[model samples]
Target: MLIAQISDIHIREDGQRCCGWVDTAPFLAKAVDKLNALRPSPSAVVVTGDLVDSGSPAEYARLHALLAPLAMPYYLVVGNHDRREPLRAAFPDHAHLRSGPFVQYTIDELPVRLVVLDTNIPGQHAGELCGERLDWLERRLAEQPNRPTAIFMHHPPFKTGNIPLDRLDLSGKERLAAIVSKFRNIHGVFCGHLHRAIQARFAGTIAMTCPSTAHQVHLSLGESSIMAFDMEPPACQLHWWDGHSLVTHTAFIERFDGPFSVQTGERIEIRTDSIHGRAP
Candidate 1:
């Protein structure tokens, strides 16, 4: 089974660049186009969070228009920048988007059980996975004791090595980690919000993040600017479950016309290739 994940789109409705620089819509459109053209494509695409710069009705509409060309099923989660009310109003048809303030659901048909968690704290940059959400997760895990599961959310429970941004890390992480540690069937946790691809270990499971479609956060740890946007191409993480373990690969969207074939069953050694006797 294959799944594609895109995060932190930060779409703006005013047609102005985010922070007066990044044009998120065009990058997202290109990313959608690339995902549509993949051979033996992903079964689904998951937008982890920050789908818009602000969760306004117009922003959602712009996002919808930008992602209209995607050929696979997709879903969204709320981020700190997201407004639950406007998001629900815009995507009323979405299963996760309803009459409530929280958007949480499970995708159970695939080989790996998917648990979507709501960690958005209203009017705050920091996040919390609190009592109600923890109880919900515990019940869900108990129901499928041995199934391989993956938790998807917007804020990672652990720090991603960036000191300044780490201030906004998830609260009640100890509680969440303890619960996940008890579930041996859990495979990994996926999230967004840092605008970079990051990985950390929490309770013995892999916590992975997908890069943003708009701009990347500067890797520098020292903070001179609060936010930075670079011209990095939009990317997505492809997760494949091969019966026993889950492996992830990243792809950047680009435009070109080509027909290609893959020889998947063969292996070549790069060192051997470099020293071969093929000179004339």
Candidate 2:
């Protein structure tokens, strides 16, 4: 099974741009097109949040319109920039969002089980897993201890070297780690909010963060580094499960050079026009 992961879209109202520069809607549209054009299309797409610049009704409505063209079923997770009620109202057909007090649920139909967690703490830029949420996760994990499962949440549990972003790290990470350590069936913990692709060793498995579909957080590793974003290439992550193991690949959304014929040592001439209409 192939699963695609996109994160931190930060869609804005129709005529607005995120951070007064990034027109996120177009970027997301490109991502959707890229996903649809994949040869063996993914079974589902999981958007790991920051779905809009602001958690407003108008923004959510715009987000709904932007995401409507996805060819396959997609799941949504809550992030710091997301508001649960508005998100639920935006997509009434997504029954999973309304499953509980928090926007957390499981996808049982796939060969690899998916457990999505809600780590958004409204009105703040940080993430957390309170006692109730953690307990719920424990119950869910206990239910199928032998099933190959993956966890999805917004905030990464470990502190990334990026100093500024780490300040807003997940609040109950230790307890989370403790719980996760006991689950040998857990395959991986995937998260977003860093706006960059990152990975680290956690409990008994690997935890990874996906890149944003728009602007990316600048890679500055130091105690005095200030928070900033850059126009890095936007991309999505593809997770392929081949019955026993899960492998991941990063797929860039924008068009680039060529896939030359390696066997013939030849280069095929293709359109060099930039996707964003910029000079190459």
Candidate 3:
């Protein structure tokens, strides 16, 4: 029941770092290493979207190299930055990876069923789920009416409150929402696009976005902004159903100064007292 969600890798083949600041590849490799080192490992690792920076074949090759060390099964959905051909070329063995038209499928196992949807709109940064993709989703949901399900995609079906980012949100969300409402067992929706953690409710289920394992979207709440890379470490989300409720935790790995504990009634001293007490 343990699921690990990683998103927005943005790997580039030419070794070009994102925004000329963050080195995404090494950070992602470290994340894979940490995931492998976990005591009770996750059942599967799902990369929500944006596996590559510019849909390059070389980039997909590099992505495979970086992610090869992961110790568990993994799956992916297409994003605005990913090319369907190269993604299929790289992950041809994966059941859900398609080439000609779209990349979408359902992963049904044990306690959960994952419905992967493709929201990528070629030649644009925005997203759309029309034609066959939408019909496919409807059929899948209809087939599994009461199974515990989680929908996975690239673009979030809800807004991120950021104007520019919201501009690229999934189109035809209303139609998608209508279909989702008919299914009662959908646990939640997971996606990637805004480069940060976001949560919302749609069609009686929760919608969530996992932050990148590379950089972050700076929390500038007012105007439209783009790619803000700081010194923040990469992170991921771990989710599981506790037989009654679903719980999620955000995990970050870094070295701290010490493992210190604090208790009530602690004392505070003034530096001026030491100067006054010293013999001048």
In model 2, residue pairs whose N, Cα or C atoms come closer than 3 Å (at least 3 residues apart or on different chains), thus clashing, are none
Candidate 2 lDDT tens digits, 20-52: 999999999999999998756788999998988
- Model 2, position 173: C-alpha lDDT score: 86
Query: Per-residue lDDT tens digits of candidate 1, residues 1-280?
Result: 6788999988998667786778788888878987887655777888988888867899988887787788988888888888778877777667566624467788888888888888898888888888888888888899998998888999988776677678787987899899999989988999988887888878988998888877887775655436555666667888877777778887777654433334654544233223322311
Between prediction 1 and prediction 2, the one with superior TM-score is 2
The TM-score of candidate 2 is: 0.94
Model 1: how far residue 216 lies from native, Å: 0.6
Global CA lDDT of candidate 3, please? 0.80
Q: Residue 81: error of model 2 in Å?
A: 0.5
Tens-digit lDDT string for candidate 3 (196-250): 8889989888888988888877765657566354556677888776554457777
lDDT of 2 at 110: 89
Q: How many residue pairs clash in each candidate at the backbone level?
A: 0, 0, 0
- Point to the candidate with the largest TM-score: 2
At residue 244, candidate 3 shows an lDDT of 49
